[model samples]
Target: MADKIPQKCPECGGSFTAKKLTTTCPHCGTKTELGIDGNARYAYVAPKPNQGKTFTATDLLNEFSAKHVSGPGMPDLMGVNKILKTVSINDVCPESGMTPLHWAIVNRNRAVFSLCLARGADASKRGTGEYEIAPIELAHREGLTDFVDRLVSHGASADDDMLRPIKEQRQVAAAATRERAAVVKETIARLTKEGKRAWYQEQVKHFEEILGIKSSVARGRGIRAFEKVPVKSLAEKNLGMEEWLIKLHDLAFEGGATLFCEKGLTVSSKIRLLLAPTKSVLDVVAVSNLLSPDEPGCERVDIGRQLEKLYVELPYRILECGRDGVLGDIRAMPDDLEGLAKRLLDICPHYGQTLQAGNGKPWEKVDDVTAVKNDLTESRGFFLTWD
Candidate 1:
């Protein structure tokens, strides 16, 4: 009988060391002796740990409320989540058909709501009695904005009569419901960006078709504006060769650029077409300086030998354009200056770079074409060899 006796204390309602007929409550220093008719009442009771509840949810509501009476962040069963996982998680109040979800919504306890959700609590379950309200509707009425979003995102229907008016309410509406214009602006912005991408794609395709080669460098994004090819015919019958020599000398003297040239050529403009496939200044310059004029090399190299070899080596024989891809206007008599300049730039990338750069500013030294153009404009004859 003594071994089976409970050891709970009365004074502080704490456990005590039981011995003989006397025991002291360690918590409050209270002493008690067993009465003739032994009863454990509040003096001694064996703790039944982990005992499954024999009562209903309605009867447990008061205890539940007491446990969670503390404010937000400290949930009722927060520390006992694992224990709750072992219980009848779907229990509801008999009076209102309100489950733990409803209670969580009423308290706006997001932690508890998430826990209940994870444990198979139904958020969309309707309450009983005069009014049927879901957890989302309850939160909406309570003006719990975050709860409303969490509920909606987790499968709560905004179309429900109970949740719709709450969805329209300014204080509780979700981000999409509240700022409707943001959706439109976001869509418009996306479409606008896509449209620009498509336009640029088409432009790239057209550019490739015109030159029969692809260009990675975008039109407006390039370092320098695509300029006209400045080619001159160099037949012995004409003084074009002499004029070209004088221009090269002035380029070295005025603009601090040394340019070597091939003696002359009467073949078609296909020589310029060779540069269409390349955009690198180094690559274009290499092809332009094909046959070295130096013993080993000099600051400049002549491309006459390479051009002569290509004229015989390349199978295609039709003249694509005028000398150095100079597109002399067919309709414009013989000396159409405006027509010639306009047609000159509509050429291969290599031809354009070489023709423009050879006159004064070397393509590689075009660090700042805009600044160079400005300098040319300001100093005129001193910075530029020829127009």
Candidate 2:
């Protein structure tokens, strides 16, 4: 081969001596391959290999969307983190017209969602379906306040659309509920309805002795309850009972707990409960005793543990304050409390949790579940002079 010439790299305008057929610019890392004319071949950027095949931008983007929804780690494993800049942030889905960012938002993948937005993912990009949906609206519909904050920070408008699918979803849900209720009412004779109404009142009596609440659940539409007797209602009729109700609601808000209502067996009412966050602490003696009071199918002392590990990670990361205490916020950690049950569990997983059968049996699972619940009521006090 002729003596390799020392010259400025055409790619980066940097100096380097060309030796092998391919040599990279020392300063910029630009690979230059020897052409047929023995000159250098300059490509815009190094081609990425995808499973030993030529990687196209579309293939890269689609793959990213796939892993982004599958959860964290896969995207970084696929080297999507390094090529984020190269992939088109606003690459649209052929079917939904949603950008990769949209899928990230829909899946609550804040890491990839933030990366896409920072790299110029179009916030204004909306799907072309009948909904013409935007990510901000989707976040709002998901009832994810933190997600709304993030999208708003990224310049997404929060204008509520009248025709959004969420509203349609609500209407469909109400209609379905009404249809189902009508069939149930039609099937059951008038005598049965009256019988159920009486039975419901009796159940409420047992429920009150358990939860210690004056109950009425206000669904934002309005509060409705049977005047004679009520199930677990957060009526705030009694001063302190409302506070406990609020705290229970916050359990769902903070931890990955779910709140659900089932139609009362006899009456047209609903029974509401916050599913235990993790480790099925509800299985504890006191808690389960409270929940199962006179309720059929609820086996006492049998706690159901959560299937998935509920990890409470910090939010927005940039701004990490989550408190409101109104509508859906914990106004304040209860004034006279030893500690938050969740805080204790977080500090020591075995503290407020129920143990599994023969597993981790060697490890201590303290049975102080009710003690923690009591600590919630007992306000922490300060002491003074030495006696």
TM agreement with the true structure for every prediction: 0.28, 0.28
User: Taking the tens digit of each residue's C-alpha lDDT, what string does model 2 give over 26-99?
Assistant: 88875555444333444323336454454334454555543121222124434554455555666565555666
Cand. 1 TM to true fold: 0.28
Each model's Cα RMSD: 33.7, 22.6
TM-score of 2: 0.28
Count residue pairs with overlapping backbones in model 2. Answer: 6
Cα lDDT listed for each candidate: 0.39, 0.41
Error of 1 at 386 (Å): 71
**Tens digits of per-residue lDDT for model 1, 157-257:** 76565455545653433442333334333433433344245444454355345434443421221111111222343223455533443443333323322
Quality of model 2 by C-alpha lDDT? 0.41
Using lDDT as the measure, which candidate wins? 2
